[model samples]
Target: MTVAVGLFGYAVAMAFLAPRVLPRLTRHGVHPNLGVAAWLSVMTSVLGSWGTAVLIAVADAAHTWLHADRLVLSGLHEAEVIVTGHEGLAAQLALLLVTAVPAVLAVILFGRLARSQVRMRLRAREHADALRLTGTRMHRHSYADVVLLDSAERAAYCVAGSPNVVVVTSGAVAALRRRELAAVLAHEHAHLMRRHPLLLTVTRGLAATFARVSLFPVGAREVARLLEMSADDIAVRRHGREPLLSGLLALSGVAPAGALAASGADVLARAERLVSPRTRLRRIRAALLTGIGVAVLAPLLVVGAASGLLLCLI
Candidate 1:
């Protein structure tokens, strides 16, 4: 019970403070890939903390119900011992019932996340199947799963699935220069290669499932924006910024409902970023890496420490 309360408090504090601190820690997107990682790590940390807390609560409840000695921290053990001594089996039964609430809630929370991912993946697969039928397949040295849709409306998006499809409209191909089209294709391919869809799925699912949690929603938006920037960086690396910038200008339109568009999120900001001189914030990048490491390992470390202490007592 003590461990559970402490873990829950830590989770709450992280959820409240991480969003405020992470933007500064990411150094305003000096490295977009690292920024995406940092945001995802923080989200994972918060959720892990809550999950660990619930698990600890259930473990402690079961331990007390079965064992003669309490398996919690000394403070919690002392208080619970007093109650159980006075109230006997009633107190233990009540603790078990109380612990069951969080366990049930956690199951529901994760179930919703799983359901959201399944629905999204199914939608993306359907969209990809339709595009494959309607759109012409392109043979390119760099990318093979390219589909050219015969649409005048400029649109470019990647459908993430088994093969990972990149769909570009006829208007985008006609509007963009050769180099610009290649850059856009690189951008979409980067999305597939880096598995951005899975990232977005998890983040957005968390945001939707835990709408009341401030960090989940903020992290979702930041992750989406940063992933676009990350793909842009990859495009620039393969084909210079100017071409990608032109490509973005050509396809400055929203994508399909369940796809990640090259010009999808924060287009103006991405264009501005492309035009601006690049800065290699080495120090900030190092700091961000450190922060990501801490965010990922902190909850696990705490759980390890508590387990070690319990082992010592045993």
Candidate 2:
């Protein structure tokens, strides 16, 4: 009963609120990292409910198996073993089917993650090779892993892998003022230092899982954009507003394919934010949003615990 309730509640809440509420949470102009945190929390809770269902289903199946056959406990050693109406077989088959769904989904999810990691590694290696030939080592802003590539492309991207190198194309180095370059480099390092790509990959995993069903992916997409904002905030603090804004406009969309670029596609929105940043969210707003996220997550935790109790009771 608890498992059934959890499943029902999860479905209704996601179907009704996720598409709208998640976007609102992520779209808020302040503290984008906090919004991403909320998104992870909500999605994790929903995922927990799915796991609870699987466990409870397996337990119920096992309990039914024990009760459905009287002869096993009837003290009739000579009696023929029988399952009336073949309910035992049906129960086992249902359990198998229930288990198979999550199992298959897990395989696919991890396979995708592995493939993505490999692709990123390959891209990093290619960048490393390019750096060897046409690149000159530069004074590291934050660290010595920085390199300058002799290319006209207005790009500044981070290669996050074994080497974790940050590359600045010659065009950007020539075109941007010292402070502008500082802001761009600062932004990319924020991505590297915080490992924002892994965050994005995790969000993509969740998005792929619920791609056809809910508005969760919208939240994930918003999270990606917000991550960029998070980095922008860091850059602004280090080099002020103008440099970051100007650098963004100059190096916009110059990131190579398969690279995480500082000034990627959302140039206009980022530019606008730099012009007049949103009023930093107040503690009240933060508390309120945190409460809402906790509210959404709490039900799943309660339901999971209740389902576990049901499993043990039977």
Highest TM-score against the true fold, candidate: 1
Q: Tens digits of per-residue lDDT for model 2 on 256-293?
A: 65456887847788788777646646863675477456
Candidate 1 lDDT score relative to the true structure: 0.81
lDDT: worst 10-residue window of model 2: 76-85
The alpha-carbon deviation from the true structure for residue 1 of candidate 1, after best TM-score superposition, in angstroms, is: 2.8
- Once fitted onto the true fold, the runs of candidate 2 whose alpha carbons sit more than 4 angstroms away are 4-8, 66-134, 141-144, 277-280, 304-314
Residue 296's lDDT within candidate 1 is 77
TM-score (C-alpha, index-matched) for candidate 1: 0.88
Worst 10 residues of 1 by lDDT: 68-77
- Candidate 1 Cα errors over 4 Å, as ranges: 68-94, 140-144, 304-314
